[model samples]
Target: MEHCELPRRPGRLDRLRQALPRLFPFLGWWPQVNRRTFKADLWAGLTGAVIVLPQGVAFAAIAGLPPEYGLYAAMVPVVVAALFGSSFHLISGPTTTASLVIFANVSQLAAPGTAEYLHLVLALTLLAGVVKLGLGLARLGGMVNFVSHSVVTGFMAGAAILIATSQLGHFFGLALPRGGSFLETWGALLGQLSAANPWVVAVGAATLACAVVIRRINPRAPALLLAMVAGSLLSLALDGPAHGIALVGALPASLPPLSLPWFDLDTLRTLVPGAVAVAMLGLAEAVSIARAVATRSGQAIDNSQEFIGQGLANIVGSFFSAYATSGSFTRTGVNYDAGGKTPLAAVFSSGFLAAILLLVAPLTAYLPIASMAGVILLVAAGLISVPAIRHIVRTDRGEAGVLAATFLATLFVELQFAIYAGVILSLLLYLRRTSHPHFITLAPDPASPHRALVNIRRSPQAECPQLKILRLDGSIFFGAVNHIAEELHRIVAQSPEQCHILILGSGINFIDAGGCHMLFHEAGAMKLSGREIFFCSLKSEVMELLRRGGCLARIGAGNVFKDKSTAISGIVARLDPERCACCHLRVFDECRARPGGEDVE
Candidate 1:
């Protein structure tokens, strides 16, 4: 019978071709465009524009910016990201987290909504864009993975609570204090519960109820927009004599004008930290969302390209008087559900959003701030992934600890500090786990077993009186040298009769200077004890380490064997022959070949 050879997989060149979109990201999804897809994208864009109407203004308010800046962020950034990004459906715009981070970082430097504040925000956006662009070019997209999923889950949950709590004043039309910690805000809310406006609360409650009902019964329905309209109409109807509900008032009807970010050194310095925080959080959010959506769509995502896309979005958006922007989880999900089939959908959304701004600008006057607060409340609720939290707590204690720490830290400490804490903790835990490698002593099984089967961890088999065999299963790095040396010393001390030690070196992948020193010390101790150390199946890398450390000369080249059987035969021949002569049991074939050798059988 003839045997057929299996075909080899594609080479690196082929893979490179697939990943080449790292340079020109739009190419990643532009191929999906067709007439049918174009139509789908158009409709999806329409839906996105309508959705962003309330979201843009609300997010601007969160960032302490004028409502128009939020709309500006939604427009240019969305178009830039879609055109240059890897994902087909990811829509970039102002997000709640990014907004809050901006406020937290820049609020101390300048008064919110002032010219100085606006200039600093623009500089921040520009700086963030530059950083993101550099990372993409350097192909550092993988670094985002260091921000663990558990940390993200916890941070989002905490941010959600903060978002909801921040909106309490708007929700009830109460004059609660602002700009403090979550606990302080809660305290203020509790203290001012009696000052709440019943009329505003009624409007908020009605909007919230309508949105919830519409979402449950018909997810595709424009529930938020519908809720806003209902709230506005209700406010108008109740405006006759006694109702004291407040509204957003009239908004300017115009396109975002071209603007340059302020270039003052003080402003740049002030915005630098905020820019870095925005860059990290924004890129993490965008890449994560793009990868997730791509997984469901069976499409490959180019992380580097996504980074470039986000960078370009922010860079372009800054000139358009926009603040920091990133991928919106809610908006992206909505786009996918609305049948978006290509990047063009996001572009269309931006265009339609600009067009809608003209007609909807006047309607802003009747849209109650209380109703918008209710929408924010809904967003806050959506951010908390209860199932994910429960799973982390139940499955992994280490990850659960990280989650808890991150959540509490985010609530009390600053946003950037919280992220840094989580990242640092994660790295520390990883290093601690890898610093002590597992070392085991292996011995051949004798009772009707497979060839050379060995017991791990613990075994009752008595080792050969003259030879000791040990197995190491990790890299011999600087961090692990002390632990490995201690284990070897303990084993040698316990079994003094086993003078000659042979190490199974196949599992060792790397060795550092500290590890080399440890090996040298062990070889010297063995030499003093009238014993020898040998290596069987030693890898080339391990041999190099020993040779460089001058330990190989002490161990002797003749004692090292490339094959296990050959090493065993050599060791048996060198064993104390007088002891073998007096032994009743012969464990090796070489024992029988000796002049006075005898077998019990």
Candidate 2:
């Protein structure tokens, strides 16, 4: 009968089938790729390729890297992210926010755009990628939730201002120093306002005005690119170069070359904190964009898989002259809107960008820096969502405080420290909320024929004279047990005549050891005072927690009811006969019965 042979070791083919999907998640959807999808992806890819030309250069300028690095990031990272990411249409590339973070953090250690600085940036990228990959592998994608949305929003607003300030020199045709504080930059700009060059200012103003009008007129147009071209033609026509207008210069006509990130202990120690901040911010940005787009695409995103894809992008792209990269809202949105049907669109985008860079590398020499500034200013202005900010400011005072703190810190302090401050404040605010749950005194609804319970304060209805009911609306844990205990004590003090207490525990989400212990001890104390504590309508998980904590048994399992009907009948049966005889507050349907089995007229 025991003829079952031990399972044979899986063959190589079997193992490959098991592991390949995890390694390359595209396998899940690659089978669906067809001729119709290919044509759609090709069109989407072409459109994205055109748009990234201006964005890549602008993003690179923000990061203090050569424009080529931005295009390079657009290539390898885009392909890698598309190949492995769970989102069908997420297009990863250099982003303005991540670029700002790079400049803000790394500029402190080394001068921006220096060889050593580039190395450090690469190290930061590698570290962030490694951290992300580790998190993905561990399936801790939910960790991003701890970084409050308000924190990110405030940081973006502050970073937007910083981006505009950084470009002020080119925008106004002044010789402002790079990496200056926002106040210092503004002071310098004001100081040099009288010396501003008319030609450069005109180019920037024309570019900004053109981009704005084009964007308003046709939202689908490549406004930044067209505006840059217009500004370039105007600058050349006015002989702006001879008039001291700076040009972007020619770019390298090649693909991304091999590179290495610094890994020495001193470098790691110096850059670790900033790298962690970068990783957190990038993960938040990438995952949020993926989820937002996935809603429209009707595709389920595996968040951990998205993390893995982003991690791989940065890690692999670092070896290809790319700085840190992540999902771009603009590019991803364009890809989806342009009818991208699969991840192949991203791969085609990389190929097209590589081809375009090689072909048009020389034309960039005519691209004026002031025009780029105009484009960047528009991008920075885009970051300030007045509506989102207004909503946050009005809805929740605590969240508003968190937003204010993050915004101020991002403006006044080190960028990494600002992130830390915001995250810490978010956790504190969250704890403040969770630790103070609401306790509502409940009574029978006067309007309901069945006498269902309702909030006593809002409904102003009659309650049982010998018993009181309460509804708790939060978790009960060590940090909150004291608060709950005080509320329980206060309820008793105010209504001592109601000697029996019934807690409607349906709203209780969790109960920890301390909470269970406090309930047990309170039950004993209540019995000593000629009263009883009962619990009803508790969730199963909370009930299990109480049982496991030994509090349920110590408090007497008979005092806990699985449903309201049993609790009402059982609790009403224990009320004093003398109280019932004279009681006018017969609030429960069970109150119709006398203390004995007989019904009252």
Candidate 3:
């Protein structure tokens, strides 16, 4: 007997095809890498490193984490995101929004800058990564769509205010308590204005002034770094540590050491809510930045793969003593502008950051906390995005409501609750808008070709006395069925003498079981009243739904009209001859041929 060969299995090949690109997104760019690309990426990476140094330190202060943790965040997470993410120029690291949120949530559980706080932050990062990884594996990356642009704008503006408030004590040397409410912080600052240290205030003001002047003269001149250097030198000149000016002190110079996040059940339980909020906010920030950059590069992005990359970055980062991080818009824009040609540029940035930390971490002791405050203040100002806020407020009232509500909630409520509230309000507003569609009464206009239908209110033309025509220009989903039913009932009640009705179904794009049942019941009610209902130009999908739901059978196939001409002719033929004799305006073609008839068409 001849040996039988089993059919070749494509199972492995199919899995490979789907898994390779997702697991190693960098593989797609490998063929494009060359000597020229390397040189471009090198320069871009150099620029990115310079930009992130001061920013990382300032963001670390914002998160109430050690300055070294920020540097570590820029290392592992940056490399991991670049290797696994779908974007060519997006740079991931410590960002202001994530930092602010981390401080807000974690500060409530433990004192800022304590061992307990650090452990809690680690737990939060790990939990968030797990959540993000689960969402990516489930292919639920599209959940970001529900986070409206208005919510982000409002949340950022609110968070920016909080950032400024948090740094005020450092800016003015007032020694305000950590993690105070916005109002309490302001109140405390007000009572201690007379005790402000002039030396620290001068240093902060000088740093802010330098940053502004340099940025105005040359936008690419690393203004934050220069300003911080000037402030540090001024603090040294004044011997600031003795003069009550706080300093960041020395940061570790070695590579990030491995450590596990605390896995106590109670710790995980306490952090679960915060972790969920951070994961959503971080993913939205990453995907939005990626898509925006890809629009310029004309590159396609896989949102699910981005989610996975971010998840892995945070998960890996937690073990390296890094807190929660996300995409940095500033670094990403600089990377693209500085001629980053591939994802390799981001990898090179991480390498450059690691090398820079080795050389400069000890020197951070000279960097005064006041200067960091000034730099972060600039960052906070940038986050407000006046143009975006103004545009949202000026254009749409509903969106403005969402923005205001979110902004207020962020100011008064917990950060997690603020985010959830904003999302919920946005969805409610969207549903409210769609629940009531425009109900248009249409009449035949003789001036147009084919006697096209026009709004009765606009054209003011005589309509058929024996029939009523209406156009519903929205979906017939469950949410909208009640409103549509009431409108249809009102129209019939207004014209009881008009026993037949015609619905122009061309405007309807979708219909569900609720909508089908509504139509079936309406048809039955009409038939009982010695009247009839007809649908013209029903969409194929809507007709299929009606048929499959058995509504078409109950309503009768003869009542379903595929075209206006056939529907008009059939309805006119069935009209009482007595009523036709009483009609003054004969709009139908059949009426023109009748004895003693007047024709408008």
Task: State TM-scores per candidate.
Answer: 0.81, 0.82, 0.82
**Candidate 3 lDDT by residue in tens digits, 32-77:** 9999898888877876776677668778888998877888888899
Model 2 superposed RMSD (Cα): 5.0
Q: Which 10 consecutive positions of candidate 3 have the poorest summed lDDT? A: 592-601
At residue 549, give the lDDT of candidate 1.
Answer: 85
Winner by lDDT: 2
Query: Least accurate stretch of 10 residues (summed lDDT) in model 1?
Result: 444-453
Q: What is the C-alpha lDDT of each candidate?
A: 0.79, 0.84, 0.83
Which residue ranges in model 1 land beyond 4 Å of their true spot? 1-22, 33-55, 58-64, 88-90, 95-117, 168-176, 190-249, 262-278, 284-301, 328-345, 364-382, 447-450, 458-462, 563-566, 578-601
lDDT by residue for model 2 (1-601), tens: 6898898999999999999999999998899899989887887787678667767887898998987889899999999999989998889999876898988889998898899888888889999899888889999887666667678678667767876787788888898976677788898999999999988999999999998998789865556667878999998899988998888776677899999776789888988888787787788778766765665578987889988999999899889989999888677766775678999999999998888778976776788888878877886776666777899899999888998998898788866466568789999999999999989988888578777888878888877878888989998999999999999999899998999999999989888888889988998899899899999999999999888888888778899998877898999888898889787656677777776324444
